[model samples]
Target: MSLRSSYYLPPQQLRAENLDSPLGLHTRNPQLSWKLRWNERGAAQATVRVVAAASCSALLNRDYLWDSGELRTDATEITYAGATLTSRQRVYWQVQVLDESNRITQWSEVTFFEMGLLTLEDWNSQATWLGNHGITVPLYRLSFHLDQVREDICTARLYSTGIGYYEPRLNGNKLGTQALAPEYTDYDKRIVYNTFDIEKQLCSGENVLGIILAGGYATRYQYGTPVFRAQLEILYHNGQQQLVDTASGPWLVSPGPWRDCDIFNGEWYDARLEQRGWDAPGFIAHEGIWQEVKPSNPCSSTDAPKGELVGTYAQTVEPPK
Candidate 1:
C-alpha cells in the first residue's frame, strides 16, 4: 500500500545567493535556497512557493514579478523581497515544495539572477583605476574581442573591485579559488563588488582579462591607493549588449612576483621577474606600461551598493568577527 506513498520528491539545489544557478548574482536581497531528497526520509518542510520573473516565458506564464505565496516557513534561505532589481536585470525563479505529508513537489528547476551594479548611478563604467604603484604583484592585462553578432551569449557578467587581494583570468583560465576576493569592506564606506558567471567564461572570439593584486585588508595598515575595477557584460543572442569595460581602451600594467604584498609584511616573490605564460590564451604585452585606469577613491555618491548591503533588514555587527 505504498506506491512511493503518493510521491512528492522534487526540490533540488535551486540556490541563488548561495549560488547554484547563479549568474551575475550581485545580491539584491537574493537568498532563496533548496534541497530535498526523498524516499520518505523525514520529508519535512510543509510548504513553499517562490516565483520571480522577467523571462522564461515570464516564469511559466504566471506573469510573475514576485510571488512567495505558500511559505509555511521551514526556510532554506529565502530573502528576496520582490521588484526593484536593476543593472543587467535578468531574474527568473521557481520553487514549490510542500511535504510533511501534504505531498507536492514538482516545480523546482528554473533559476536565474543577472543584476549587478546596484548603484553609484549603476556605474556608467568609465573603467579606470588600475595600478602598479611599486613593489610588485600587480599585473593587469586586458585583451578583448568577441563580436559574433547573431546573438548567442545570453548572459555573462563579471564585475570587480580591488584595493587588495584579487585574482581573475579568463581565456587562459584561473577564475575561482575563492580566497579573499573583492571582500573586506569599509573602504571609505562599503565598496565591494563581485558577480561572476562568465557563461562558461565565454568563447566566440578572442578573449582575455587578467588581473592580479595583493595587499589585503585593503592595504594592510598603511600606504593605500592600490586600486582596480573591471566589468564585463555580454548578453546577446539578439538582445544586444556587449561591454568589456575598465579604462575603456588599452591596458597592460605589469610588475609581478610581488616584491612586497604586506598583509602584515611577508611576501616578496620575484622568480626573476617571472612572466611565464602570464595566463596564456593569446598573451600579449610587448613589455608593460599602457595604463589608463585611475580613481581608487573619490567616487562616492553616498556609498552602500553591495546590493543594499545584502539583507532581510538586519545590520549590526560592530566587530562580530
Candidate 2:
C-alpha cells in the first residue's frame, strides 16, 4: 500500500488525566492518552510524539512547553513532564503517531487542560465565606465597575464553592452550562470547588455577579446553614491582575424564592417572591430588602465544615433540557 493511504488517522479522543480537555486539573503532572483508529486488522501504533504548548498558536509555531521527541513505543498514554505547572495555567497539546510500518499521520487536533489551585494558599488571604444568616435560600450579588481597568482583559476565571448547592451568574447569565454544582461532597470531610472561564461573560463598564444558594449537603448532612466562598481572577494582557472575591467586594444578599430547600426533602420556590432585576446591573432593592452578607460557616466554629478543599475533577452533571 502507498504510504499516503497506509498512514493511520491521527490519534483521537485526547484526554488529560482521563478527562476530555478538562478544566481545573489539580494534578501537577497529569497523564495524557489517546485512541488509535485504523481499518487494518493488524494496525498498530509503533511510535508517537506529543507536544504541549501554552497556546494553540504557540503549538502551531513549535514553541512548545514540552515535546516528547519520537519514542519507539506502542503505548497510547504518557505522563506529562513539562515545565512546572502553576495555578490557573492553561496548556494546549497535540500528538503525532506512526503506524506499525512507520507511516506517519498528521498532528492530532489540539486539546487543553487548565491547572487548578495547587495549594490552599492559592486562595486570597482576604477571601472569606459569605452567607445570608436569616434566609432559607439566599440570592447574593456583587456589583463592580471595570471601566477603570486600563489594560484589556486577557482572560478571567471564577473559582468557587458553597457549603450547599450553587448556581453562579455573571451579568444576569449563568457562568457555565452545567447545573447542580459545585459537586456534592461530604461537607464535614471535604468540599469541591468548581472553576469557570468567565471571559466572555464580563462586560467593559459594569458587571454584576449573582449566586443562588440552596441547602444541599450543608443542611441535609451537616445540619447547618449554607455559605459560599469565591474569587474571580482577571488577567490583563499587560500582566496586571485583578481579583474580586467575597471579602474584597461589597456584596449584598436577600432572601430568594427558594424556601425550605433540601437535597433530600426537595425545594420550595415561590414565583411571587421573586425579586426581579436583583441580579442585573443598575437594579436597586428597597433599603430593608437586601442587606450585607455576613461571614458564615457550616459549623459553629469558624470556617466550619473544616475539611479539605479540593478542585472538582470529576465529570459534572448536566440539567435536563
Candidate 3:
C-alpha cells in the first residue's frame, strides 16, 4: 500500500485569510492554509492544487473561479490570486496534495471566505453615522417596508459598527453570534466594522432594524456617548440591488432600560422599563418617547471621537459552546 493509504490523512483545519470560513473578509488577496496529518515525520508535500468556485457544488464539479494548477512546492499556505473579488462575494475552495512519492491525496474539506466592502469610497459614499448625542445607552430603531420585487432575493448583507459596543437586531432577532463588537480599537485611529448575513432574517415586508449601543471600550475614567452606523445591501436573483442605510432614513432613538452603564462599575438595568416589541414590526411608540437621530460626520470633523471605519480583522468571540 502507498504512504497515502497507510499514513496520510486529508488536509485538516483549512483556513482562509488566517480565519476559518470567515465572513466579510476585506482582503482582495486572501491567503489559504491547511495542516497536514501523517504518521511519518519526514513525509512532505511535493505539490499542491487549490481550486475555488462561487458555490460548493460548482467547486466539486470543477467549475472553478480560480485554480492553481499543480504547484511544485511544499508550502502549506498560498495566497489567492483569483478573479477579481467584489463586495459580498462568497467563494468556496478546497485543496489537494501530492506526496514526495508522487502519490496524490484526496481533496481537503471545503472552506469559504466572503468579501467585504473593497474600497474606502464604498463606505464614504454609502453610510452615514446616526446617534443620539446625549444618551449614554440608546436604542436606535428603523422600520421600513420591502415591496415585492420582480425577482427573488439572492442575498442580503448588513455592515455595522459603533463607537462603543453594540447589539443589533433584525425583526426582533439578534444579528450575529458575536458579542461586544465591533471590537475595541483606538478611537483616534480606526474603527472595526462587522458584517452579518441577514438574508435568512429578512421577511417579505415591514422589517425593523434595531441597535442598542453601550459604552463598552470607548469609555474609561469618564463616560462617553456612543454613535452607530449601518448599511444593508440586498441583491436580487436578476442582478437587481437595493440598499437600506441609517443615512437619509427615518431612524428613531430612545433611551434604553439601562439607567447607568460602565465598564468597571457595571450596568444597571430595569426590566420594567423595557420597550416591548420596539425592535419588531408594527410597534407604535409612546408619544414623545423616541426622537430622531442626529447625523454625525466622522470624516470631516477632527474633534469627533470616532475614527476611520474598516472591516474587522479579529475573529468573533463567541460564548462557550
Candidate 4:
C-alpha cells in the first residue's frame, strides 16, 4: 500500500560546530549562524581549503574561504583524494572573507609549511653551536733533544685563552715558562723565533718532544684552586728546524723583537751547561789528539822557527834506510 511520508520537527534543531571559527559563543542564537565547507587542495595533497558562511533559510553564503595553495587571493585550491603529502612537499594557503553586503573581503593571512630538504647554507649565518673549543692565543717553547743519535732540535708552540699562563718543554729539557704579570711592560703576549739549533742536544731518529702549557697564574689565585694546564707531545726525526712561534705582548712599551732575545741570545747555552754543572763534564768526552804540536824553545828566534815561514810548511819523507 502507498503511504504518505510525514516529517515531524524535533524540540532542538541540529547544528554543526566549527572548531576553527573565531566568533563569540551564542547558544541557539538565530541571528548568527555559520556554515563550514572544506575540500582537499593541491595535486600533492599538501594543502587544505576551508570555507565559512552565515545564512537564514536558503543556502548559506560563504563569508570566508581559506585555501591551501599559492598563498594568494586568486590562487586555486588544491585537491587530493587518495594521495598523502610527501616529506619533501611544500604547502601554502590563504583565507577569504565576505561582509554583510555580500561584498567579498580581502584574502586573509597566508600560511606556509615545508618539510625536509633543509640546507646548511640557511643556517651558516648563525652563531656557532654551544661547547665549541679552540685556541685563543699563540705561544711556544724552544728546546733540544739529547737522547737522539742523529741530533735534532725540538720546539713547542702554545696559545692563551685570556686567562693563565704556560710553560713549554722539548724532549726532557724545559725550554722556558710563559707567565703573565700585571705590572710587567708586556703581558699575555706570544714569543716567536726564526730557528732553534738544538743539534748540540738533539740526537738522531725517533725523538719525543713535548710542550707543557701551564694555564694557572700565581698572582690571580685566591686560595687552593689549581690553574688549568695542557700538555702536547710530538714524535719527530731529523728535519729542518723552522721557527713558527710569535710574540703577542699587550704592553706598548717596546718595539724590539722579544723572541730574538730569548732564542737567539747565547744565554741558552750557558744556562744549559751551568744547570748540568758537574754532570755535564761526564757526558762530553775530550780527544787528546792535537791538531799541531811544536817543541817549546824559549831561546829560539820569535820571527820564525828554523826556515819555516808563516804560510810555508815542509813535508819530509824518511829514506829507505
Best by lDDT: 2
- Residues 1-321, model 1: lDDT tens digits: 111334566678777766655544555777778887766666787778788989999887789889888878777668888987876678888777777667776676787766666555665556545554563576777777776632377767677767666787877776754655666666665656566667877676767788887878755653365666677767787777877755644656677766776666678776887777665556656643434344453234333222232211112123233
In model 4, where is the ten-residue run with the lowest total lDDT?
248-257
Q: Candidate 2 on 1-321: residue-level lDDT in tens?
A: 112443567789999988888878888889999998875788788888899999999987889899988888999999999888898899999988887777887678899999988788998854667764678888888898763353488888888888788888888888777777878776767888888888877877778989888777777676467878788888888777888756756788888887678777787778989988888888886778887754433224455557677877777888888
Estimate the TM-score of every prediction. 0.32, 0.89, 0.86, 0.19
TM for candidate 1 is 0.32
Name model 2 segments beyond 4 Å from true.
Answer: 1-6, 39-41, 147-151, 294-301
Q: What is the C-alpha RMSD of each candidate to the true structure, in Å?
A: 16.5, 3.1, 3.6, 35.0
Question: Which model, 2 or 3, shows the larger TM-score?
Answer: 2
Candidate 1 displacement at residue 15 in angstroms: 16
Instruction: Rank candidates by TM-score, best first.
Output: 2, 3, 1, 4
Ranking by lDDT: 2, 3, 1, 4
Better of 3 and 4 by lDDT: 3
Question: lDDT per model, in order?
Answer: 0.66, 0.80, 0.79, 0.24
Model 4, 1-321: lDDT tens digits are 002121111111112222122111111211111222222222121122333222221112323222122222222232322123332232332334322222333343333322221222311211111110122212222222334344343432221112233333344554422233111111223211111123444435433332222223322342111122222222236554332211211101111111212212221122322222111112221232101111121122231112100100111122254
> Residue 160 of candidate 3: its Cα lDDT?
88
lDDT of 3 by residue, 1-321 (tens): 113553357788999877878888777888899988865677889888899999999986789999998899989999999898997789999888878887777778888899887776777445666664577788888887664542378888888888778999999989888888887778667888898888888888689999998888777623245767788888888777788756756778888999998767889998888999999999887758897754443333443455666776778777786
Off by over 4 Å in 3: 1-9, 37-44, 55-65, 124-126, 149-151, 221-224, 294-306
